[model samples]
Target: MISVLFAVLTAISNGSASVLQRRAASTVPDAEAMHLSLIRHLLRKKVWLAGIGLVVVAAVCQAVALATGPIAVVQPIFVIELPATLLIASCAFRVRLSRSAWRGVASVTCGLALGMAAAAPGGGSESVPGYRWIPALIVTGVFEAALIIWSRRLRGNARAALLGLAAACGYALTAALMKDAVSRLDNGGGVLALVSAWQLYGMAVAGVGALFLLQNALQAGSLVASQPMLTLGDALISITYGVTLFGESLRSGWWLLPELIGVALIAAGCVELARSPLMTGAKPPPPRVR
Candidate 1:
């Protein structure tokens, strides 16, 4: 129960941090956008500093949650972060959430609950063998490298979306590795053991890569495109890793019907939220009557 609560806290902190960082990142100079020097400037901004603080808080919460809960249970809960970001942005930016936006929030909420419940994901043990890690890590690297190369040739929202997706993959892998490492720590591996573990090193690199991609995504275009891709992409990929790496499972044999339905609702909701005025900072589309 505490793990669930910690996961919720992680979601809240993560959602709020995204909004804050986006708001702060917008003020950054265009020339410095993709450069390493940008982080220096961002660190000087109070808002960015605050956002980083929240991110630290979020990471702590997530680590605790992963230690105690199934990766399947902990990670999908992050999908709600999209709607949470919208809500936080609406209040902080003083933007209005239109009727459609509220509807979208409700859709995401119900969908998340239904999907997670219907999925009924089961857990795995701490001892993931070395053989499983080889293919998984290789595939992850190749896919991310491909995404980076492809996105580099594009511009605007498309590039942002692709980069966000890549970042999502990185985060998913980081979460999985974190779970494994934490499990190791729980099962008698001390801090010294963790320092020597390859998963710990892998998680660090992946975490940095994810943050790098996220910053670039924010700079490239609107959160409208990037947010959903980041949210849904991470959730889905995390679910896959849970089953593959961590030996987690989901409900099947006809129970998949509701799972599919829930996925549909989540897609619809994220799309609606993306197109909303609150997220895009544009006027709401005109209501057409038959």
Candidate 2:
């Protein structure tokens, strides 16, 4: 339960960061997209800096979540990020959520509960084998490279989706590495062992890389295109890493039915939520005197 609580906190923090980053990123010129100059532009924006601060908070929460529980249980809970983003954006824009938006929130909430109950993710190791990390790093690097290349050929929403997915992969890999590194703290090594671990450094590199990719994704298109990809991609990819790297287990056979259904509901909810006027940057209705 501690894992779930921390994971939820992480999601909220990440959600808030995404909204703030998106605000800053949207102002960058199109010519700057995907270039290092894009980051330079964002660096001057206080909103982006605030987002980065929240990212640090999320990272601390995530480290605790991964350390306390199975990665399978911890990561999937991040699917709430999109819904959280919606709520935060609505609040910031001084707009009321539509009925459909509320429905979307309900669907996502129910779906996550159903899927987690059906899948019952559990029994993962604290540490992943060193040998496993080599292939994971190689494959992840190749995959992200391909996505970046493909994204460069597109514009608007398509580019955002691809880049968001790539960022998701980076985040998932970071989480896995963080788990491996953080586990040392409890494994008799304490702080000295954690600091000495190569995984700790790898996590930092991956986290920074992911942050860069996310900024580009935000700049490239609306949240409608990027948020769902970022949210769902992170959850699914993280689950894969959990199972493959840390040997996490989930229910199977008949349980797959509810799990699949839950995924469908979550996806549908995400689509609906992403299309909300508030998320799409439509002008909020003006206040009227009563």
Candidate 3:
């Protein structure tokens, strides 16, 4: 129950963080190069500073949740951020999602709920060996770097998707490192031991990289394009990390079928939402002149 509470709190903070960051990003000069100067400029804004605070608080909540529960359980809960963001955006921007888009939102909400309930992942090792993380880090770093480069070669939604994917991978790696750090706390490591651990440094670096990618993804295109990969992709990757790296296991055999169906529903909903004009604040096309 404590883990569940923390997961919900993480979702709320993360959802609010994204909305605040978007608000801040809109006020600043648009950046395409993903430059450090962009961070400097945003730091000067009170709005962006507030967003950063939420992000920090979110990170704390995420760490606590991961420490207390399986990554599969914790990360999937982050999906709630999408619906929460949409609700907040609607109130703040006075924008309304079309009825069809609302259906899409419903599908996303339902799929996440059902999928998580079915998977019910369990049985994870308290700690991962340092050597195991070496291969994982190298692979994740190379994959994310490649995606970022690919994103740079594109424009518009394509770029946003790629950058979001990169950010998603970085975030997953950060979670894995975070889980490792938190797991060690029970072994008499305490806060000081976590501070001294390599996983802490890895998590910090990965988090910074994820933030850079997220800023770039926002600049590249609409939230509709990036949000799915960011939210859903992170869940998928975190599940992978939990199973392979942390010795966690999900209900297998026939249980896999529902999980796949749930993923399909999520993907379908994301596609519908992405194509909605509400995502970009663009007016719908006019009726034909006949």
Candidate 4:
């Protein structure tokens, strides 16, 4: 399907972007964590700019995927971004990954396939009702605010995880708003309606906010700490938005078992990958042979 294909493209672009952005963000001072100075610092780094370019490409692909497919289906495919990031990092840094890293990647791949197949998400309204958006926005705003506030008190990986999850929620909100805005064009409202839609502007704001939060997440700690939260959190939160806000359906009853197993596999895979030196840009131990 076009949506799935585009979603995969989106994941690749995003994965590459994340690695570049992290490299740039790591140079900034820890005191600059969530400050505007962080953005200013990153703006000077060519690597960050390159990452931004990839982000734009991912955004275009994401827009196409969301327009052509259900948010539940499109967003979950991003689970591959972590593995892609690790692999890209491996290539970029010329670090060899251990066998366990490959196993983690395979586990994530199989888990996503199983989870998506089991959930089989389908049947959602393209346009959510305005009233429904009211509560959704309020709840999301509160949740993100709490996360940011809580993150300020933590350090290292903990801070990165919190900010990453917050950014994930923001990205999910952006996708939801993007889908709603684009529905104007789908419904034959043409360019005028699309431009005038509030969702369009909201999506822009949410996207920028999400980008800012993601920068802080990268600056907070190693990719090992931030990537899993960003990857898994986005998928889970987007699925919630799809189900609650867009009325998307997922299989239930017997399907719950596979879904749980898939989630476990994904979580375990993330943990394994998180332990890799590649994630932290640290040199791996020497390979021993018989």
Q: What lDDT does the true structure give each of the candidates?
A: 0.83, 0.90, 0.80, 0.91
Model 2, backbone clash pairs (residues 3+ apart or across chains), number: 0
lDDT of 4 by residue, 162-236 (tens): 999999999999999999999999999999999999999999999999999999999998787888888898999
Model 4, position 68, has a per-residue lDDT of: 95
RMSD of 1: 3.4
Candidate 2: list runs displaced more than 4 Å: 88-94, 280-282, 286-290
Each candidate structure's count of clashing pairs: 0, 0, 0, 0
lDDT for 246 (candidate 2): 92
What lDDT does model 2 reach?
A: 0.90
Candidate rank order under lDDT: 4, 2, 1, 3
TM-scores for all candidates: the values are 0.89, 0.94, 0.88, 0.94
Clashing pairs in 2: none
What are the per-residue Cα lDDT tens digits for candidate 3 across 66-172?
A: 98988888888887776666666667766666677788889888888779878988888868988788787778878887998888789888998898888888898
The lowest-lDDT stretch of 10 consecutive residues in candidate 3 is 278-287
The runs of at least 3 residues in candidate 1 whose Cα sits more than 4 Å from the true structure, single-residue gaps closed, are 29-33, 88-96, 275-290
Q: Judged by lDDT relative to the true structure, which candidate is superior, 1 or 4?
A: 4
Model 2 agreement with the true structure over 111-213: per-residue lDDT tens digits: 9999999999999789987998888889999999999999999999999999999999999999999999999999999999999999999999999899999
Give the C-alpha miss distance for residue 238 in model 2, angstroms.
0.6
**TM-score, predicted candidate 3 vs. hidden true structure:** 0.88
